[model samples]
Target: MSEVMGQQKNNLELNDNFEDHDSVSDSQVVDYLFAHPDFFVKHAHLFEELDIPHAHKGSVSLVELQSEQLRKKVRLLNYKLNQLISIARQNEQIYRVYADLNLRLLATQSMEEMQLVLEEVMQERLQLESVVIKPFIGAYAFPEIQRRLFVEKRFRRDKFFFGRLSEHERKLLFPQQEANSVALLLLGELGELGMLAVSSKDPSHFNPDMDTLLITQLQQFLSILLPKLMKY
Candidate 1:
């Protein structure tokens, strides 16, 4: 009986030791790999032997799984690269169109010719819904009260206003045309010359946060040109 009891105690202690040794956690394994980073480099054959559970396929070799993950990352990078390229090409085209319009504007002899040139480029080339130039004190001037209100409200701080306009403002600026979104440029040094309203069908097309580099150049050129044209 003593011999049997001693044997049983020895068996229990061996089992307990085995359980403790087998209790290696996933975190401990990860820490071990992180410490010995070159372990995989030394035992490269493990890449073939190790199985990584896959969502689509039942399981894949470590090398194959890593290759797939890399391919997905490359595809995502390519998609973003293509989007940037497309935007750059669009910006270049816009710059060319504005450059051509500037040249045409420089050659205009009268205000009528200037207005026609603006309408032609903005409507036809830029594909804007409408374009209207309203001089402060002239035959085709915006209503005095309306002009003052717009200057006070829209051009209170900035020389440019973008995004949606009130119904009254829309009607005054674009008479019969639909203007979901509008870009209102205050002409002259202190916005005394006129207002140049450019509209688009797309509601989100003209936002205040949009880059004004091209339109700013146009505004400066118009400010200098309008005074000379108004004299005629």
Candidate 2:
């Protein structure tokens, strides 16, 4: 009887101890660690023992995981910075070309002079194989098939079209020349005047994916210049 009573007493003591230990919650431990910042410094070995969940695979040490995350962020930032720099350099080059063309256009005294200068500059500086400024009347006079292929399909409403051209379209725009791709910019307001067609032998030279800000600006500039030139 006395042995049974002693066993029960021991069980009660163990339950009390467990209850006391359970009173210290996980938040309390985190709070205690925050209170003592030097705790990790005092126990440097804990760094090796600490395991953090990783994005892939099993686990990694806390320090190792943090370092990896920082490296990834740095790589992402570097890639973005490089893209911005590349875009800026490209914009600078485009601006220089546009400025040169604008100066030449402004210097011309007549429509013939402007056309000659425009064609020569585009071929020499811009690497275009063929450049033509077709008047609306000329475009209207095109054969039914040619008009439907280029005018009706491409410039029905859009001010600009850039991409590979069909063989017939290429031949129509650039007769006696081999052109694999073309960019057509509507010359006047709602294309009342006509269009400017620039072509290249390289298939990828003009595509819909290309940035058209520079081309759009050039179109607007020509719109202002062509009206005055036509009056001359």
Candidate 3:
């Protein structure tokens, strides 16, 4: 139902004939949202888990979730055979971006390349229209949670108070000048972070009314994938 999710469904839908292919259905996504509101709500513990959804819960484990619930959610998110194909296609895009940037990164040898990879991830993985990943001004050298405050503050300000502030409020709080850009942070080998943010020349992209699920999924994606990708 969220734009990103909608695009995800659309991207997956573009794959092939639905007559035989099992596919992701919009109804299933809606059903989960209606049934499992708390299950989908964002939590910090998610950041600690690394097992990919379909992979066996290996030694590098994620929190044991309600297995059936997770299965349904994954199934719903993934849809059917064609959707799985779409998911594969999407990953290929991610790898291509990663491969190209990895080569560039090796030559450039700049830590900033990681963030650049994130910029590419936004386009490739998440499929947003425009993206900019400004490093947190003091975040680089700060302690782990210190940088988090900015994200938290931004979320809380948008959430607890407004609960759904209009688009105007988002711009004032997360403006480019503050360097409060939403980015997927990489500590490399240690872990990664995913951020949800929008942009606008029209000024409505950050509007308070926007759905928070966008942010929630970024964190969720990191929760499931970051630790698994870490080197042993």
Candidate 4:
């Protein structure tokens, strides 16, 4: 009977000790989990059991949230891959078109024929608004004053110019056609031959930093061809 009484008293003392202490706070639970990095490895079942608040689904397990994130990343990667493929195809097509134009220019007989070919290929195939070759001399020469102004304003340093043109400049270069942006290529090695201007209706189509690979080839070919055509 005395042993039973002593055991009862010990149980009461244990209960009283527990009541004297405060309950564990949320911060204490978080601190304990942070202190033990391998806690998830030990309690792996919590990956599926723990509920995470979801804006769209009300609640989702941690495993479901991770899966959704992976799916979104995969979709974004696929979208970027598709964009790169589309740009590559476009570049290939542009290269082929420029190649065909270069071949056609070599076969051209007269200045008029050359201009016609440029207009047809550029306007019809390349979808440019206008293409013009303004010579410094010959029967189809551009006015000297306007030519000088253009050269001073646009070709002070660079052989190629690309950007929006002023209203007056647009009228001189592409009088009959609508032009928001233009790319200008100086024709001769010494810039004595003339200027070749290609215009687009879209304002952002041409810019200063565009690559001149195809256009540079075209300009070099024209510089050789124009002198021969002008003599005849």
Candidate 5:
């Protein structure tokens, strides 16, 4: 009976202390925990009982929540690393293709030879559906729509355009074949000399979202090379 009375007294004292400190802030508790690192070691069972609110799921143990966050971070890092590797591989492949095309262009002695080499590279190497290199001298002879496209200088700002082409545009560039998308590169001083058009059968093959580094490099190469070819 005496022991029971003593336990009841201790409980009453603890309750009174809690009531006195009813407005204890979270920061104060955190600071106390940080100061006494062995607090959890003395009450190790708290690891099993402590519940933390999760972002996606219901309340979980603190350890489980921390582990889940680490796993998510690792997964995100792996996905970003994979994307970087894919981009590097794609860049390497594009470099090889450009190198081969440059070597072929160097071997050409005449304008016809240069055109044939370009067509071969576009068809066989790049797997394009159609390729056309047209001079600006006869731009007025094309249909009214095409003549307007050239006369209006639509590509004067960027020197290039890429995406799905209209029916008339497709017909004007790829008359012998069908194309779902196209990349039009204005050659030689903003369409002053001509234009180079490359078409693909896939609708999304040449969208605006794609990186145009390869096409831009090719345009610069052609701009320098075409004038020399025409002179010969």
Candidate 6:
């Protein structure tokens, strides 16, 4: 009975915590700021602070309540608005990086040329990051050269890395990160076909939240392009 009571108490506490968070979220101060982006620059700080919990001291007089509430409203709204602005800036930068990459990828006429050009683009476009062209492993080869690369056992075997690695033979061809780094495939070809890895001293630089479509499309561009380019 005691154990059961403890579990019940724990559940109650969790439910209460959830309710408090929901109440704060429903305050909608941050939402209003986001909807009107123009107000953000002046009131961003308030929202940022309000994102976390704030307590009213018990000794505070009721007269101060109005000002206190206003401060909280502004603080939380400011933080959230700043976050949105930051996201917009980051997305703009990522788009530019891919745009620069596409320009170079389309210019290559052969697999070797593409590799050189892609790596050069990744380096210049993404702060000297290293890139690799990984063909699919453990699957049927469309043509002859890929079969040879497979037979030669030239592949990096890591499922943590993604993109086009034909459902079979996959390997790491180029790398610049440390022995232990969490990498996000920000953009690439398919079957690990065309992949990019950015390295930084900060271990969290490559955490999983990054968007990978840009790199994925790049991989797609290379998958067919590499095979056709080899002929030239």
Off by over 4 Å in 4: 1-43
Residues 1-232, model 1: lDDT tens digits: 9999999999999999888976888899899999999999999999989999989899999999889989999999999999999999999999999999999999999988998999999999999998888899778777899988898998877999998999988888888998999999999998889989999999999998999999999999999999999983
Each candidate structure's TM-score, on Cα atoms with residue i matched to residue i, is: 0.88, 0.65, 0.28, 0.83, 0.71, 0.49
Residues forming the 10-long window of minimal summed lDDT in candidate 2: 138-147
For residues 1-232, write the lDDT of model 6, one tens digit per residue: 9999999999999999888875676448688757877874676565444433337554443335557878999999999999999999988998887887777778876666866876676656665445554433323223456434443432344323422232233223323243233232312233433223333334445445556677556655655565565432
Q: Write the per-residue lDDT of candidate 5 for residues 59-169, one digit (tens) a residue.
A: 999889879889999999999999999999988997899888987787788767978988888888888888878766542323556655854654756888888767776
* Better by TM-score, candidate 4 or 3: 4
- What lDDT does model 3 reach? 0.45
Best by TM-score: 1
lDDT (Cα, tens digit) per residue for candidate 4, span 138-194? 888889999888899999998889998899999898889989999998889888899
| Models ranked on TM-score | 1, 4, 5, 2, 6, 3
Any residue pairs clashing in model 3, and if so which?
A: 22-80, 23-80, 24-79, 165-208, 166-208, 167-207, 167-208
Against the true structure, candidate 6 reaches a TM-score of 0.49
- Deviation from native of the Cα of residue 108 in model 1, angstroms: 0.5
Cα RMSD for predicted model 3: 27.9
Candidates 1 and 6 compared: the better one by lDDT is 1
Q: Whole-model Cα lDDT per candidate? A: 0.92, 0.81, 0.45, 0.92, 0.81, 0.54
List, residue by residue over 85-137, the lDDT tens digit for candidate 3: 99789767756754564354344323355446656655555554335332332
TM-score quality measure for candidate 1: 0.88
CA shift of 41, model 1, Å: 1.9
Report the lDDT of model 1 for residue 98: 97
For model 6 the local lDDT of residue 130 reads 52
lDDT (C-alpha) at residue 141 in model 4? 88
What does candidate 2's lDDT look like per residue over 1-232, in tens digits?
Answer: 9999999999999999888997889999899999998998999898899998876858999779879989999999999999999999988986898888888888777767977887887888877898877765442334555545676788776889999877767777888876888899877776766678888889998998988987888788788887777762
For model 2 the TM-score comes to 0.65
**Model 2 whole-model lDDT (C-alpha atoms):** 0.81
